[model samples]
Target: MANTKQAVPDTLPLLRDRIDSIDSQIQALINERAQCAQKVAEVKLAEQGGDAVVFYRPEREAQVLRRVMERNEGPLGNEEMAKIFRQIMSSCLALEKPMRIAFLGPEGTFTQQAALKHFGKSIVSAPMAAIDEVFREVESGAANYGVVPVENSTEGVVNHTLDSFRDSRLKICGEVEVRIHHHLLISPHSNADEVTHIYSHQQSLAQCRAWLDRYWPHAERVAVSSNAEAARLAAEAGKNGRAVAAIAGEVAGEMYGLMTVSANIEDRPDNTTRFLIVGNQEVPASGKDKTSLLISAKNEPGALYHLLEAFERHGVDMTRLETRPSLMSRWGYIFYIDFVGHYQEEGCQAAIAELRDRASEVKVLGSYPVAVL
Candidate 1:
């Protein structure tokens, strides 16, 4: 028994030594991979003429993940393998060219989360005060790409984003959808039962109106500019141990030094928001693509119908359609649409040409790869 116990202790040490050796080997391989990524950056830099060209490709990253999932073995699940490759590609892309992404922020908003999720932590992000400001940043060359909320699955389209597209010439280069989980956050010292008022962005407050009405019947619901800003104010005002909370994310908890009192407070459990990437140049066709356009109808009956009929005739699919009152004329409206297929495809070209002849105005915003979830 004494000999067996001694052997057991020695064997455990040997196993530990083997594990340490394997960990060292893994560290060396990781370093070598990083070096290879830097070399790739050097080659891309030379090809694109110094530092001007944008090298981080969102669509390429999606393709890489899809391929990784397809080739993954059963020992590790597909999602697990894809996540590993996603981070690997993120690191490699950082070395290629650190993307500068702009999102609706004061930070800690769901839009910011979507931007980071889509671009990964490798990107350098800038926060813009307004959704329109995010679009303008990318339009004016201040930001490489801008992420703005386009719509919420439950609450419907964000009118501000649609209105901005009416006049801006920016193109939709990519898209991302993020699941939103709102929390009731308060200062560490504040008691949840003693809360008097709750604050959040106008949209957020509106989204959770039903829930708040049922729960905090007497507490005043206030709207702020953004969720993160609301959280900041809640943390700052909790000095008396009386002021209440803000509806924001757990990530925003540390940002404002607030603690989450209640989690997942949104009306819908599956609430999600879709965001768009706006840029100056139109991306070339990826096999699976979406094209957006702004079309104005002539001052005649059946004008809008005639425009949509072209899609039916060409067999092109219209994914989304929205009408916004045109600023130029009274009672006039512009129709914004998202359609399937690339602009280069024969059917798509035919549809555009037909709409050009049939509509008052038709502007092709651009065709880009379908967004990865």
Candidate 2:
């Protein structure tokens, strides 16, 4: 090597100067991007003649994140890069309007974490006590968007969230998946060996059942309204020197000043929960998308078959199919079908048209961009 490092030192001072210069450039470019975002707001207002403009378009943001990931040549992975851009987009959007997002929560819940991940920290996250309340919050204009858990890898479908869609006029604008990590947490001052009872949400208790049974079998496992609530209960009990512990996530543990006795105690290492973003506005196609539909099959033999056959005939990829008890008829069933294509697309439209001719009722819940990050 011809003394490759002789000219410039790889010293801290030199690196600091280079990082400072890079930071300045990044700051300048971010401000320029913000200016462009502001101009976008102006253009929309001018074009619509001051009508209500949806500043936060789910499809648009999804497309932007997808592009960011695609172009990333990172030492940092694509998700890490996309997360950086997500915050930038969040800040720029805040210049136009700060979104009020609602989630089934009491702060520190996974649903709240998903909401923040989807909308970024600039949003106003309202904690609703129930799934229906989250839907109502967005529907009543109390919140710009609502996030509710739809299904989990370990537990299965969230029936309450599914049933809410049956009657709500609100549309599914987007979907977010959250990796669930359950921990056996206790207050710092509490004695782990003295733990007498464990608390968590029912689903959480189920997810961590094997682990808890293995290590904490002697402790009484109690199911509460939510893991965050369990954390609070554990903290309260711990302060009084009672033998209580909670099974929750890092968010809850941090919130309650708890220390983890066991980490990632979930039975399934890759346990994840999928949440839906419910909003008033209908999202347009964003290249890669998914469509959700609620249908009532005619009470006849092969009624459901004909409805499903249309999707196959039209070459639409059906992703998920769920059945809920139909209120229209006790013996009847409401079908919740999710497919991999925008409802407005030719194939999806053709399938739906065939479905309308076959089923007693067909309702397009929404067509939204698929999750990118």
Candidate 3:
């Protein structure tokens, strides 16, 4: 046993040395790649002119991440490997030009997290107070892109986001899915046992309905503008000697300097939220892509059926279908649809043409690469 222990200790130093050597090589290669990215930027500037340069390509980035996953063969999982590559790509892209992303937030919100997750931490994030502001930021060229919550697995769709698309010319450039794990947080100055009021976003309150009912039925549930706002309110209340707790995610809790009283208190274990990246330009096909469209059928019988029949005939898989009231006319409905395949493809083009003929109006929001990371 002593000999075996001695052998293990001796091998550790050699293994660490090899790892250090590999790390040095990796660092050198990364810098070399960064230099290449800088050169690419110079070439693009010379060709496209300074004012019109676009450094980030959503389609290309998605393709690269997908290729990384496809070719990965390692002890590390595919997603773990892709994340490492994601940072590397993000750093390289920063060398070209840092991306500015707008998201719905007061900072420390899940939309902010989704923005970082989709665009990487290297981006400069601008927090907008409302979903429309996020869209406007991207539309007015103040931000390169915007991230907004589309739907949650437990809480259905974010109607605000759907409604924002009704008149917006901004396109869906990318998407990200983030797993949500809510935590019960108390301010550092407050006691968990003395909590009188619970604060959270209305959606979050609904998500943890059963859990809250089971554990703190007597506590007053206050719906705030956002989870981050709830955390801020809870932190302030704690300092003022009020027994208030916030239900929020880790980012908000940490940002507000609150202590976790209970972790992962969400009603469903697989709770996840989907966010969309909105930008001014339409993304080209990335091989595996999804297209979003807004269609309004004639206010008549079989209007909806005729609009959907084209996609079925073309074998285009429709992933999501949502109905929202049309702002153009009272009592009229518009269909927000998402389907697999890019608009540039033959199958999708044919399907869309048929829909345009059958429906009153058909607008292609965007065709973007599916989420890779």
Over 4 Å off, model 3: 1-10
Query: Per-residue lDDT tens digits of candidate 1, residues 1-373?
Result: 1322243334778878766766787678767888887887777778887646666665566677677878877788987877676677777777766778889998888888888777777788899999899988987888888899988977888999988887798988888788888888999878888888998988888778888999988999888989999998898878765777899887777798998777888999889998888887667766778888889878788888898999999999999998888878998888988999888899999999999998889988878778654
Judge candidate 1 at residue 184 and give its lDDT: 87
Model 3 scores a TM of 0.96
Q: How accurate is candidate 3 locally (lDDT)?
A: 0.91
Per-model TM-score on C-alpha atoms? 0.88, 0.95, 0.96
Give the winner by lDDT: 1 or 3.
Answer: 3
- Distance from true position, residue 146, model 1, in Å? 1.1
Candidate 2 TM-score versus the reference = 0.95
Report every candidate's CA lDDT.
0.83, 0.91, 0.91
Per-residue accuracy of model 2 over 1-373 as CA lDDT, tens digit each:
2332235548999877766766887899899999999999898888765537888999999999999999988789999999999999999999988899999999999999999889888998799999999999888998999999999999989999999987899999999999999999998878999998999999999999899888988999999989999999999998887868999999999999999999999999999999999998889999999999999988888878888899999999999999988988878989999999998899899999999998888999999989887
Q: What are the RMSDs of all candidates, in order?
A: 5.2, 3.2, 3.9
- Model 3 over residues 1-373: C-alpha lDDT tens digits? 1321233334778878766766787899889989999999999899999678878889999998899899988778899988988888899998899998999998999999998887777989799999999999989999999999999999999999999988899999999999999999999999899998999999999999999999999999999999999999999999998879999999999999999999999999999999999987878889899999999878888889988899999999999999998877887899999999999899999999999998889999999999997
Q: How accurate is candidate 1 locally (lDDT)?
A: 0.83
Consecutive 10-residue window with the lowest summed lDDT within model 3: 1-10
Off by over 4 Å in 1: 1-40, 50-52, 74-77
